[model samples]
Structure formats: C-alpha cells, structure tokens
Target: MDNYSVKKLSKLAGVSVRTLHLYDKMGLLKPSVRTEARYRLYGEKELLRLQQILFYRELDFPLKEIGAILDDPAFDIVQALEGHKKALLARRERINTLVGTIEKTLVTLKNNTMLQVEDLYEGISPEKVQAWRTEAMAKWGKETVLEAEENLRSFSKEEMDGLKTELNDNITARLTALMHTDPKGPEVQELIARRYQIILRLTGGQIKMEKLEYFRKLGELYVEDNRYTPVNGMPSMELALFIKEATDHYVSEQKK
Candidate 1:
C-alpha cells in the first residue's frame, strides 16, 4: 500500500505537522507503518480517519469524545455529521432571535416604553415557555415575571446545547461506572457521592433540597428522554443495572 510520511501527509491535508503529531500522541490517529529509520507513514485508511476527526472537531466535540466516537463501530460518521449540521442551523436561528430581541430592546429604549424580560425572548418553544411562565408565576408571582423571562433569554440554543452535551457526557460517564458496581456497596455509594458533588459543582454548590429533587428529575429525564442512550452505551447500561442493585441493597439494609 502507498503511504505518505508525516510531513508529506500534513502538507497534502493542509494541516500543520505539529497538529498531526498531536493527534498521533492523543491516539486519535496512527501511522500505517514505520520506516526503517522510524519515520511515520500514513495510508488511505489513516487519511479517512483524519477526515472523520476533522469533521467532529469542526462540530466542537472534545478530542477525547471524538476519539471514543471514532473508535465505536456503531458510530455512523455521515449520520452524526448530518445531525451536527442540523444543530448548527438551529443555533443560527437562535442567534437571529437574539438579534431581533436586541433590536426590540433598542426600540423600547428609544421610545421610552418599559421593556420587560418577556419581551426579550421573541421566540421560545411553546411547551417550555409555558412551563417557565407557570413556574415563575408560582415562585416569584406575576410581579417578577420579567426577571424569569430575562434569565431564559440569556441562553442561546448553541449555549444551551453545549451545556446539555457537556452535562450529559459527564453524567453518563460517571453513572455508567456507578452502574457496574454494587449501589449498596461503599464504592458504588462513593461513586454516587462523587456524582452528587459534580451536580452540586455544576449548580455552583447550591445543592438544596429542591435542587436534589431537580437531580432526581434529571435522572427521570434520562428515562423519559432517550438523550442518554448515545453517551451511555452498552457498558453504561451495564453500570446502571449494577447501581440499581446496589441501591436496592442499601435500602434493604437501612430497614434492618
């Protein structure tokens, strides 16, 4: 098989040699073979893998996640890339909404009209918007409705998706580990505790009773939502099963 040296490959691919070296070190790419002088040579297969890596990197996937995704036999690169394009387009729409909101804010300021938070978000999903409105009414009363609306307007779709992806990956990775071991077992509980800490840290260390309830809801969301399935693959599912057993054990022991 024909092979190109690292320098040659980098030049051909329009990427820096240093970038190629880093990918090699990260195990995201490997040479097809090494010459007698120990120089790296990459072939067609490596080039295709490099293309896959570049595509995922363009979508802002962390290098580590990219590696795991590329290594997965079940991972469909074309399908994933299509999904990423859809996500990017959705983000673009949110940016347009934000721009419109800013324009509205300016007009309100110029006209001396009182601008409320609700006016800031011109577009929000009907279901979530209604839920937020309901929650705001219940918690802060109608008087502070603008405050909740303002907070909702602070995040764009890209920002929200990024946050969700990070959290989902992190929780899935930890939960998958916890599921493998006994939940009643100290080690498993320790893992759960660590996850609890992660949740707290994500919430800026304000893990109050309501926030704990929120965490429970988040877990239920995983069941209600299939978003967890992709990150928590087979191994992760195995881990969840183990964790459930451990939790049962702990509960039964508590009754003793």
Candidate 2:
C-alpha cells in the first residue's frame, strides 16, 4: 500500500493538517502507521475514507454522524455513494421547484395580480389531490408531505371532469392517430407541443413545461406506467409509446 505523511495526505485530501489531527483524536480517522518520531502516516484506505468524509460533509451530514457511518462494519462504499447521489438529486429537484415558484411569484408581483391558492391546482379534483396527498404521506410521513404544500382542501370538480373529457376525447385520440407517424416528424412534434401547452393550461403555471428534463421524465413515466403502455411497447406500444417518442424527440429538437 502506498503511504503518505500526514501533511501529504492532508494536501491530497484538501483538508488542513489540523483537521486531520482532529479527526484522528475523534477516532473518525486513524493513520495507517506511525514513524520512529511518532509522525502520522496514511495509506490508500485512509485516502478513500477521507473522500467519504468530504462527500458526507457536502451533503450536510454532521461530523459525528459521518464518523459513525464511515466506521460502521456494515458500511459499503457503493451503497453510501448511491445514497449520496439520491439525496443530491432530491435536493436539485427541490431547488428547481423553488426556482419555478419564484418565477411565477415574480410574474404575479410584476402584474400586480393575486395568485390564488386554487390556481396552483387548477383542473385537478379534490379527490385526486387527496389521493396524491395520501400517497405522499404514506411514503414521506404526513408532516413532511403537508409542511411544504398549501392545504389542498377543495377544488372545482367540474374543471377536473372537463380536463378528463378532453384527455379521453381529444388528446388521446390525436395521439392515437399519430402513432404511425415519425415521432421526429414535424406533425408529431407539433402535436406534442400542443399537448404540453394543454398540460400547462391545466396546471395553471405550476408545471414548468419549458424544462426538457421534465418532459423526458414524463415520457419515461408513460412507458413505465401500465396505464399508458397498453400494447407490445417501445416503438410499437401504440399511442402511449408514440407520445413518449414524440415528446422525447420534441425535447431533443428544442435543444438544437
């Protein structure tokens, strides 16, 4: 194993020697060996451990918790990294939502218009909203689910029914007809754009249709959700896969 002096390891790990010394005292990190003069030296394993420490710190994990996690006999580096990746992704998604909310709030401020709470969930029924709330609460706990959202107590049932009618009567029909068309073709892309607009309308500006990743993820949802994928699937999954393909192509083209 390659060994590094405390100073060299500190430089390589981008940590101060004092910090490394502190970690050693806390039993969070121990050097691989000691020199004849009692100087500290680290090995490759110590270097990797220091990296894990930094990663946890970046994610706001407390030093004590980070130390415990790294010292756990059951700890697996890959699993820890995967947890970090998931937490980061969730954080990014929250940031995007906040940014979108800020943009809408800015527009409301500029126009001197009030943003009604009901408008945040336009064209969605109380029943559906409640269903969503139930699912969220089950997964993330009631307080966590409700603390960040406006109380979704009521909504116009008629608006939700109208949107459902439009989806069943108009949108799905149009998508079905275009199933055989090239997803990248002008006609299909146009239809996809129209569908996006309709979603924006129904959402009352809550959904950021402008995000290419959002649309791409929605396409993935259609393929993964059995409600959308009714047939063989992929290019042959009929209207469901057609919408997925068309929306994906639409996003790709928009990037150019």
On lDDT, the candidate that comes out on top is 2
Task: Please list the residue runs of candidate 2 whose C-alpha ends up more than 4 Å from where it truly belongs after superposition.
Answer: 1-3, 33-39, 55-66, 76-86, 112-256
TM-score of model 1 (CA atoms): 0.35
Prediction 2 global C-alpha lDDT: 0.59
Task: Give the residue spans of candidate 1 off by over 4 A.
Answer: 35-38, 59-62, 76-86, 105-256
What global local distance difference test value does model 1 have? 0.58
| Model 1 Cα shift for residue 159 (angstroms) | 34
lDDT tens digits, residue span 18-126, model 2 = 9999999998889988888989989999899999899888878778879878778776857766887898899999999999999877755633321243333445666
**Cα-based lDDT at residue 107, candidate 2:** 55
How close is every model to the real structure, measured as TM-score? 0.35, 0.34
